[model samples]
Target: MFTFEIFREEVITCYKEKKQQHKLYSQLENPSPGNLRNLCLIIFSNGLSKEDTQTFNEFFNPLNQSNELETSINRFDLDKLRPLRNFILGKAKNPKDEVVKLLAILVDFQPRPYENWKKSNSTTVIENDNVESGEKDSSEIEAEIPVNTEQAITALNDANSLKSNSKSKYLVVTLGLVLLLGVFLFIKYGTLQKQCMYWNNDRYIAVDCKEKIPGSEVIALDEHKLNNFRRITRPDTLSNKDVSRVWYSKVNNSVEFFTEPGHHPLYDKPLKAVTAYILNQHALEIKN
Candidate 1:
């Protein structure tokens, strides 16, 4: 867990100072071309256009009414981070406007290890250094399972000969049944997928959530198996590809919402609900 309170203070403090500096630069209604040139350099170096300087500066100025800088900064707010991101960015707020959010949930959100850590009856295989020491990690075991195939050319040839003469009526019947079961399952899975994505676009961060984020914070989730988390379990957002997002429950045990590209954290719900959900679901706890 991060010192969220400390990070919040750092963000507020930095913003206050930067806001003061921005006030000074902003006080000038018309800056000289040389100053503008420097500003232009800043923009170009940061991949912004010279023509958009006014808009960019204003956006970063907090006091600016409207600009691109504003839109970009809006995306980097803490409320937009995943539980894992909350553990990585720490308390420092970068001055840059283009802070691309990456999906690194393992950097934050540490969970308690499972109680029974040594109950494995199966041994993980080792590629090298195979010795009397039988201890191995999960990676070794996963690798070993993929290489234990038995060669079946002769058996396959015999089976082919047997099938060439025998009517194989039983095989045809079994295959037909399997085909029917597959279709039925496909229909059921389609229904579940829709339910998983039911709440994707409904909960606006402004209403359904209460994320009072101050600045960049990183929440580590080293042991949390994010990949194992199923997409909404019911029917999900109908995405064509796999997606990841930091999500918190909407109505306690009810469904959760995800952020696009990466995860965003939500707050301000009752503590009991958040606590129960984390302990029971969310994978906030580490599993390593």
Candidate 2:
């Protein structure tokens, strides 16, 4: 009994109640299966408990790569989603009650009736009405019925079979073309790897090597030298000049040092003034 419109309304209501960002909400205003899937992923990632999140990742990750439910609503396989519904309900407390309702709608989703079926039924009703109204001789009508019925049924069956075969062929050809296009794009663009770092005046800028800055002298990319850059803790014994010579930036638990004051080549964080700490306790000295 569930319809796509019902699912859409439920999701839109949930989004509003949660006060999710306007940009994402705008995307849901005219939802496609692709965008709806993306929104569901965001919801799952943000709403689920740690244990539930892990289970969701394990169950849904493989399906994400497949073309299982990315197409038209009629082709959607609700059986694939039933196990997820069961798992969500099995939990002691349902933290994601909204997700449970959405899954239920998907599992119960009914495809709309085909137009041909409606036309066939309408035609049958008209024929029956004419017979009942005594518009023709009863015997004559009965004699004509068997031949007309047989021919109509045979023609309908043939038309349906041809339609089914044509659709199958179209799907196969479309898939092949898509596959070919994907491979072509990968081969062309994927090979040109973006340079991650470029050396600037006395320091390296953590930017794409291809980035253009007018009048800036950029040296050749040296990944080995960049990788070797490490933070050296300033010793209190050192002069102010020595401390100024090295720039530092804290990266997680560790601090990274550069030869000159600039942003980190990897982290992109602005370098800070060096602090007085004994080199022996903090880091090993790296010779320039």
Candidate 3:
């Protein structure tokens, strides 16, 4: 009545038990050829009556090695048990009864089945817990990255502050040196000064502190454009005419250089007034 797959499963289970018990030995409770029939009959007897079932079950029940002797079945002995399985269905009324008989015989000899189930399920739970712990470790690793970045940014800000302060000091020193040089040039060669005034109606030059209009075809120059020439000793040579000279130095906030000794003359154009302006300057070496 049983399929080939069901019969194969029983045989495999029987073989695994035989491996554990050591094939070379025989157990005390293991039924020999004389009692093998009697053992099958006992399990088969369960459906027959209550009293017979109890006595038979206690007779052939497999015992654990700690408290009882070991029994083993080789390939030949296990094959021998297969024939007894057929007898179990001999008087059964239906296929369902036959299947029930097979399951009862296979499982009856297994002791402490609940203990095995509990251990297997507990091992699965431990494996699942290990996976969750790995996820927690990964999140902690991600957390440290931002902490490392913040520390780097703090160090960079400190370094930039130090550099900016140093640059400010250099700019202050350079500006102070430039102002000092301009003052020194002003005092040395700026001894002569004069002013030529021009009215809205006409222009004139002051001769011995007297304003006079030119009676000759002499060009006029303004104070704004008369500072280009710096090395002329005589003012008359600039325009080939009689010119006058004056020194407005030691006066009211005034300095000048365009002056002639004889008469104040005019030029064809207001050009470079070549006089000494202290053009050459000595360089100073910076000591580190």
lDDT for each residue of candidate 1 in 1-288, tens digit (9 for 90 to 100): 233343334333443454343322221123333332332332333353342444345333446544555344433333433331322234334422211111100111111111111111112233223532322332343334433244345445444554443346557868999999999999856444222111122332111122223452223221111222222433233231212212345555554533211233344342121234443444423221
TM-score of model 2 (CA atoms): 0.21
lDDT of model 1 at position 244: 21
Q: Per-model C-alpha lDDT, please?
A: 0.32, 0.46, 0.36
Among all candidates shown, the one with the greatest lDDT: 2
What's the TM-score of each model vs. the native?
A: 0.15, 0.21, 0.21
Please identify model 2 stretches exceeding 4 Å from their true place. Answer: 1-162, 165-173, 176-184, 187-288
lDDT of 3 by residue, 112-196 (tens): 1323334655777887798578556545544444456787576555555545654676688788888888887776335323333
Q: What count of clashes does model 2 give?
A: 0
Writing each residue's lDDT as its tens digit, candidate 2 over 78-162 gives 4544433333334322323334344432222222121222455567788778745643343343344335777857766655665
Give the Å error, residue 222, model 2: 11
Candidate 3, residue 55: CA error in Å?
A: 14
